[model samples]
Each structure stands twice: as structure tokens, then as C-alpha cells.
Target: MTSTQRTSFPRQGVRETAIAVKTRFQSASDVLSDCLEEIARCEDKIHAFNLVLDNQARQRASEIDDLIARGIDPGPLAGVPVALKDNICTREIATTCSSKMLERWIPPYNATVVAKLQDAGAVIVGKTNMDEFAMGSSTENSAFGPTRNPCNLDYVPGGSSGGSAASVAAGFVCCALGSDTGGSIRQPASLCGVVGVKPTYGRVSRYGLIAFASSLDQIGPLCVNVGDAALICEVIGGYDPRDSTSIDEPFSGLLDSCDKGVDGIRVGVVTELLAPASPDVQAAFTKCTDKLAAIGAKVDEISIPELSYGLAAYYLIAPAEASSNLARYDGVRYGLRVAGQDVESMMRATRSAGFGPEVKRRIMLGTYALSSGYYDAYYGQAQRVRTLITKAFGRAYESFDVLLSPTSPTVAFGFGAKQDPLDMYNSDIATIASNLAGHPAMSVPFGLGANNLPVGVQVMAPTLGEAVMFQVGAQIEGLAQ
Candidate 1:
């Protein structure tokens, strides 16, 4: 389906829909019905949701309608339907991480973002699928099954947040929340053709996100457009005492920032990030830069060579952290546990049976990296490389307001096209640098690329620079329109 074709489903965006619902132009229930109807119509083909909370969502909508009748505003979201990636804990709802180990494990508490969404009057629709333990570039790593791209059912929606991106692209929801560790959010948003944000590491609370790599992991929004993404970010962002890494400052007025045009903004087109991109992707990027230049922004090509080591550094650091975080899933505590002749045997049996091949592979890689003999040569060196990348970004920011690149090296590929692990790992080459630097990054759908599939232009900002990042993203979005 072409970009024009998708307009039939979502019909309107977050702000418009919220206003209509709030002003009695439409009831919250009516908006939710449309969402559920759309999910029912295409979910079988798209497989965007792991669980659809129809009865629960309807109940919430009814409550919002009651609030409106009482002359009390629900909040900013005002009855907007939203989906949560399976990895984000939603009290009593299964947070599977698309892995069999946690298939039936219901989180006892809602994640910080989940609570924030509810407070904003957003109705929780359901949990979306992902790469098992958030480990693969394609949703194929999911133990449940692969989530096909809504744009082209034959193609893989980029992962490990593929289902969240697909849900928005398929019009299953107006917005969804996803976690980004490396390129999980942006790459999938690019491939699936939507807006995805990865806020600065601590800008949003991470209190209940199932850890993939604690240091690198961040919860963010995936939406149909930039305005909605910004609103959701503001709603879910802010300091949370529960999260030690949470930023102490306020994160409001982001929606307003979207309207601030990119005039005089210094936009850097990263030469290194663009080098590995496919010709179609590069062409689309060139057009994006040209559009920015036409709009009175200073667009110029710049090189950040230290970013070349991002993928290698990310592979080591993220896995080492994963090995530590995942160690808690032993047979004694929660999740699937198989009995054995002894404690040691039981632990081995449970892990071997519980984790998928990809998850196990990452676990092994992480364990080895952190091992006594290789710590300094591998994991320690990777940390040092991460510092270099961070410092390089700092210097680049001194001269550039924001950096630009293709969100993914190529558009969404067919399922099973990248069977080799290294090929799949390379999928995040253009996006990993932002995570390493703990910077803000987002993917804005610019236009279609090879095979007429959608392509995304990435906008990156320094730590706490989300406001300006959205400004650029909104401009790119407007150019596409």
C-alpha cells in the first residue's frame, strides 16, 4: 500500500481526535470503536498486537466520556488509544518480551510510562510483539512469530519494536510506546514508515522497562506523526524518583516546539552515517537535506569518524549489560521453570528451554565479553570506544544544532532475507551511534524508497535537545506532505 492509501484508516491524528472527543464532537467510545474495528480488520495479516484489551479499553473510554459529561477534562491525550510494546510492564497484563520464558508472567506493577499514559487519559489498547528479549533486527526472533510489515506483508517490520511500529502503520492505534536499545525503535519506525523517538537516556523514566541493556535501553514513542510523538513524550517524560537515572528537569512544551520551524537551524548531514546507505536511501536523504536548505536552514555535510566504531562497541556493551540483567530469570524465581534432578541441572534445563536461539546467542556473547580473561580486551575497550563516540558527538554539537541521516541503511527487506546474524546486526549501523552517545534521536517518514516502500530521515540532537529534534522532525514531516 502507498502512503496515500494509509490515510483511510487513522482518519485523523492525535491532537485533532483528542479535541473532537473532548469537545463532545465525538465520544471517547466512538474513537475507540474505530480503532478496535481497524485492528480487527487487519490485525490477522499484520499481527501487530500480542493482546487486544477490547473490554478494558471500552471501559476506560466510558470513564473518559463520564469525565467529559461532568465537565472535567480527562487530560492531554483525552481518550487516545495507545499500544504498549510487550516488553513494557503493564500491571496484570502479560509483558512477554516476545519470549516464551515470560509468556505467562504478568507484571505486578505498571511501568512508569504506562501509568503516565493512563494519567493523561490515554486508553491502553494492548501489548505489541517484539524480537524475543529485544534481540534481533527483524521481528523474526520473536518466539511467538514474526511481525510482518504493514506496508508490505511480505516484508519484515524492523525490530525489536517491530510490532509497535506496525500497529501505528496499520492504523491499529494512533500511537504506541516502544523501547530503544540501539536502533530498536527508530529502525523499525523507518522500515514501517512512522515517527519514532528515542529520547535522551534519562529524559524519560525507565522504572519498569524490562531491561535489554540497562545503560542503553530507553522507552520512547512511536506515532503516526511528529506532533503526536512530541505530545506523548511530554506526557510520559519527567523525573521519577523510582528511576535513579531519571532527569530531574521538566520535559513539557514539546508539542509546542513542533511548530517552531527549522529556520537558522544548523543541520549536519553526517558523512559516515550516509556512506553505507543504499542509493535509494541516499537519494531520499539528499532530497530531505535540500528541503531543509530551501526552508532557510543551514544544511551542510559533516564527518564524525568515531561513529564508525559504534556498532562494534554497542554489540559488546549492550550484551554485557544484558548478561547481567537477564541473570535474574533463574528457575527459582518467576517465569517458566522446568524441574530437574538437581538445582544446577534445573537452571540449565530451564534456560536452555526458555530462551530462543538468538537470546541464547546474545547471552553467550555477553557472558564471554564480561568474562575474567577478556574483560579488559573486549568489554572494557568497548566502554572506552563508547566514551570516544560520546565526546565526538559533543564536539559535533558545538557546530551543529542537529545531525541527519537515513534511519536505516535500506528499506524493509523480505522475511528471511538476512539469515546471517552479522547481516542482521548491520541493519542498525546508521542508528546505533545515538544510543552510544546517550543522545536524542527520531525517525521521520520522508518518502518511499526502493520498491516504493517508505523511507525515514533520522534527526538527532544532543542530550536534553528533544525540543529542537522534534522541530526538525516536524519540518521534515511537513516537507513530505
Candidate 2:
């Protein structure tokens, strides 16, 4: 496709073809072609996708066309092309998790969310890049190379869902799936000027998604707007028997509540969380709060003292779990494995060569924290802190329907500035608390910052309260316009 043919869609949202497909005016193949053409035009600059599933997407789109021809309903998202984070498994596509360790590994089964989207007639365009093993806040840590922000190429795309965020922002896909562990989904969504939702932990099944910090990781959608995110979440969110961590509750009314404005809703502005944010971010967040107030919702600045330690506690707990979960990639089973003279040597060789710097750092930290001599001092203390943070959110939720804050302290930063692992991990400071509290949180574009990059206001609700979140998010989305 020529540049003119590829750049046909407006930069603000999903392509016209994709919108037509969703509205039932065109076949899935037509929408898929538009997205593919865009990807071909911009992938080199954005580095959004690690692998583009052109053949499979085309074949799936054809199947949807056949269904339409037969007078069979393909569902609301029929013909829409969406991208998946590399960590989410697909039947034949390589789910690398943005690590060389699994560069060529193809999952035999699909993640519950991926299967759900496919069943809804959405085409899986490809798997996008991510931080290695979802270990970093900037996509710069991807084994495949960093995914640059579409808004500003010099800056990092908030990760580990940076690829998904960038792709959606650049209009390469209608929507994308991203897994949030810490601020992976929300932060990237913030930076890329998209809507990213991190559902209450366990609300979305984790059956085929590569585990990062199991308790903290939840898969969600990155889309052009709140409505699209709600639609995608409704299709993916539900109980899954295969996932022990999946909740057995009825589906949260996220989609049903999107049209319900946040009138009379109590939105709490977490004072502690906002205090540390940059001036620009704070200003934008305050503006969003004021907008909410004007809309007839009660807004209050609430204090949550325990939130101060959220980042420290998350680092400990996440890595401890990561160390245990990543043990399966020792090269003896699936993924890249270099043969050594003996088992131990082979394992050491494979890990040392396959894993990236950030991955190794976290693995080492996790192993050390979980070790017998240091477990109590590090992992145990972190768990205690986690409990305190959860309690803090619970206490706040008692008086507020939802908690609001800046998703990240600032907008996207220069790629190389966060090379230090410790500095990079701090990027998730504001978002980790929600994950620790097991609450649903969303990042919606609030305003542009001093750098002209987007700033996102995070709306978080109590566990299993996604309906409340969607209601609030929809109101914010409107105000943002």
C-alpha cells in the first residue's frame, strides 16, 4: 500500500474501515487489510509488533466474511482487527513475552481473552512487543527492541504493554490486549493517549497468559476510547474454570454501565498518591476532578497514608513470585535452549544467554529475596506492606465509590534516561497500589501536558466494581473531549 492508501484513517481513533466493520457495513477482511496496511507503513518507526500474523488474520477475516454471507451474526466486534501483547498465548502465533527465551515458541492453546475475542469475530492481527518478561516500565527493555511512543519517537512508550498502546495510538489496530503487572497497561495507555483498563485481579482469566507476578497480573484492553475498552472488556471478562485464580462471579456490567453518567457518584482523589505527581500531571488530574465535580459527582481529597509504600512493597512481592514463575524457562522444555555438557550447565547457559539485563536483574533479586536467609527480611516484609496498602484502599473505598489519581508521575520520558533498572521500576509508583489492592483501575486521557504529550487520570474502584469504574471512565472520557 502507498503512504496515501495507508494513511487514510484519522489519527484520532480507529480506522474508518475498522469502524465500518464494527458497524456491520463491511467484511472483517476489509478492516484487517486496512490495519495491515497501516502496520506496514509505520511498524518500522513504532516497533509496535514483534510478529505480524498476515496469513492467519486474512484467513480468519475470510471466515468472518463467510459467516456474514450466510446471514450468521459474527457479533459486535466482527471484522475489527486487534493486537495482542506478546505475553498472551495464541494457538499458532509465537508468544515470546518479548524475550529471546521464547522467541520461537508457539502456544498450543489460546488465552481465554484471545479465544473470547476470536469467538466475537475480531481478527487477531499479531502479537505486539513488550518489556522482557513484563519486567520494565519502558518498552525499552524488550528483547526485540523498544517500542517507541507514536506521539513522540524519542520518548519511551509506557510498558510492558507499550507496543499495544503505541499500535492503538498510531491507528495500526482498532484495539489491543495488554497485561498489567504494576502499571504496564495503564501507564502505556497514559503515554500513548489511549484508554487502558486493568480489571480487578481475577476478573479476567489468566489461563494462557504468561505469568509475571501472578497475583498482580491482569489482562485488559487498550482502545481509542472508553466505550471501545468497555466493549472489549465485556467480551473478555468472566469466570473461567480453567484458571484457578479466575473469579466465579457473574460478569461485571462494564458495557451496560458505560452510558450511565457519573452523576451522584463519589470520586475520591487520593491525596497521598497525587502529592508526589509532577506539577503538570497534578494540574491535569485536578482539572479532571473539577470536571467530575461539575458533572454533579461528589469529589473529595481522601488520604491513604499506606499508599506511600506501595512501590517498595510491590517490588518485593512481584519479584519473589516472578522468580518462582520464571523457573520453567530453563531451556529443558519449551523455548530456546542451548545444549550443555550437563543439566545444570545447560540451564545456566540458556538463562544467561536468553534472558535480557532487566530480566536477569529481577530474577536475581527475586531469587535472593525468596532465599531462606533473606525471605523474612524482604518477601515477608513486602507481604505485610501489601496487606497495609490493601487495607488503606479498603478504608478509602468505605467513603468513596472510586479512587482517582494520575496514572504515572509524568508523561513519557526519553528512552535512554530510564536505563537504570531501579529508576525504571519507579515509573510504576502510582499504579502498583491498585494492583496490590486487587481493584479495577482505568487510565483515560485527561489532557495534554507541558511537553504536549497526553496525561491520563486513573479511576479505580473496589474489587469486582468494574461497572462503577466504567461509569466514571465514560464521564471522564466525555470531559476530556
Report every candidate's CA lDDT: 0.92, 0.87
Kindly report which residue stretches of model 2 are placed more than 4 angstroms away from their true locations once superposed. 1-19, 22-24
1-481 in candidate 1: lDDT tens per residue?
A: 5432333234467788799989999999999999999888788778888899999999999999999999999999998989999999989888899988998899999999999999999999999999998899889999999998888887899999999999888888889899999989999999998999999999989998999999989999999999999989999999999999998988988888989999999999999999999999999989999989999999998999999999999999988999899998888989989899999889888899999998998999999999999999999999999999999999999999999999999999999999898899999998999999899999999989998888999999999999999999999999998
Model 2 lDDT per residue over 155-255, tens place = 78889999999889888888999999898999999998889999999989998999999999999999988878888888898999989989888774667
> Residue 129 of model 1: what lDDT?
92
TM-score of every model versus the real structure: 0.98, 0.96
Candidate of highest lDDT? 1
Residue-level error in angstroms, candidate 2, position 458: 0.2
| CA shift of 12, model 2, Å | 8.1
